[model samples]
Target: MNAEQAAFLLAHALPPEARKDCWQRKFTRAHRSDLKRLGVTDTQAERLARILPAIAYYGTHGPSLAAARTPLVILAADAHKAAAALRVVLEGRDEAMQESRGRLLQAIESLHPERCEVDPARASFFHSYDHREPEALRLLTALQDVEQAAQHAVGCMPKAQTRAVAHTYPVELIDAALSLDGPAFHVSASAESKFRRVAALCYVAAGHGEPLRAIRAYLRERNASPEN
Candidate 1:
């Protein structure tokens, strides 16, 4: 089938209620399960899974990461090469980035429930993937990698603060930042009280930085964005 036809079929295949509840709300493994049951191809599911967090983040946070530009630039200047990499994605609207973000948003829009499907009780709930599932195991592995990378990023932080800092932000955000793809720009300055903490950590973990110097810059930028 053609693109429009594929989109329509996908939309129609989804439970009326799941379409409604997930539109601008939280997405979970359970939602991913729904997509699979509806026969969404592995290719489609993986593509969607990779960027859904970014989509959800931007939906809740804001449309753009404009405020983070200066912080990212400063972090880059401080020898955080990863920051520079992420900044490039944010600043430039390359074809790949545009197409990826566009496709994700379109898919989400198609899944949005119609007015009649708004009631939660109408949607059947299913168990999300547990540790036993291959998908869950794969995700577990990826998260383990992210945690290890985050440790390097925050390695310079004090013994007392490191754990808290690492635990606060979602791993999905860090993964997005490091990928140097669509979600890289989805990291928002306003989303976290200590956005720079996670941002700097992602940068350092991704590579390049005098940790002490980078932390200083992150703290300095924290107050500059009053909205955060």
Candidate 2:
């Protein structure tokens, strides 16, 4: 094991668990020899241990864990530096999400002055036809309508208006709303096929293809049809 091996192990070992106490304990005891074999010095291994929890949290919450981890593995000056870089990446993600939330609020406010007020205390009312029933179904239907309208608008708009509104609330919010359920099974199947096609690209980007290929293959096979 060398630096490349160490990076590979770190990439795969990041678990989805939010609380990393068990992962940390097991990682320290079980992987010590492997880490040493990978040419990670004791000090570097300690730095990795310290950062594992944050890495795990960020991995589970972020849009693309592979994309988030790519820079750390590729660009960091050393193992310790990589750990610090991971923290910065996660912080940037948090800041971006905060900015998106602010933009969402501003967009909603701009729709007002039609003499309508949203009671923060009665936020549920917007979603609910029945006061006692939170209207998740209603919200989903509304989101679908928004997505359809946005797609049509984007298709019809002049290139300038399309580009301008690309950053606006309708496009962003509709996308966010639609993605809330994650990808559908058929879409996920398609994505897995696409992922496999791009495995080489990911490998070139990350300097290793095995982990990504393994994950993509798993997704593909998991959704594979018996007839096909």
Candidate 3:
């Protein structure tokens, strides 16, 4: 079947409520016989044959499909990376950057409600920790790591009081990562936040100055209780 025929058949298979003008545009001049051969039933085939032309005509002058898919593509890529990082933390595997691994895992787990459920496996990890100084240090280190990841994901808008410098990527991209659904959105939020914290820490460590002071001040003020 031709592209038009395939488009029509696909549209018909979708729910009636989903039959938007866009679908009609993509399926113009679709053939009934072609649709049936492609597995659409007679009833579905007939419906599509009627609506396809109008949809195609409207879409021809409407937004390009590429425009709709661009954000999706970006979000998908970001999510894949985040998921891979989360898997490492969940398995207790050594991540490339040890300091940020725990924080990364925490932020990721925070995004899901499943973490709050009483899973035996998760409980085992918490209980297994020995109450020793070394273990305590390790836990603290992990928390720090996760915090850094969260900050990076949010994207540091430079502030004056802290020395932490924000990453140079577009703020909109960070916002998109936080707001978009799917894996990339989650991953970007985690990774971006972690990266930002790391940058801030490095600047302080090198004695270059606190780059994120302004950002920290802003967060602090925002979280403060309002005056009566």
Point to the candidate with the largest lDDT.
Answer: 3
lDDT of 3 at 28: 24
Ranking the candidates on lDDT from highest down gives 3, 1, 2
Compared with the true structure, what per-residue lDDT tens digits does model 3 show for residues 55-165?
Answer: 223213333445544554555455556555544554464565554656654554466435334444445645663222233344455655555555454344332233323
Q: What's the residue-level lDDT of 72 in candidate 2?
A: 41
Candidate lDDT scores, in order, read: 0.38, 0.37, 0.39
- Among all candidates shown, the one with the greatest TM-score: 3
Q: Give the TM-scores of the predictions, in the order they appear.
A: 0.17, 0.21, 0.22
Cand. 2 Cα-lDDT: 0.37
- Candidate 3: count of backbone clashes, pairs at least 3 residues apart or interchain: 35
> Where does candidate 3 stray beyond 4 Å?
1-60, 88-92, 95-99, 105-114, 117-228
lDDT of 1 by residue, 1-228 (tens): 234433443333323333443432333565546545544444544544443333333223322333434444444344445444433433448898666545543444455423123344433558442122233233345544554555454444333422212221223333222333222222234533233343433333323222233334444454465755
How high is the lDDT of residue 11 in model 3? Answer: 42
Give the per-residue Cα lDDT of candidate 2 at 193: 43
lDDT (tens digit, per residue) of candidate 2 on 93-170: 577765654454454446543323444676673564222122323333454555455445444544331111111111
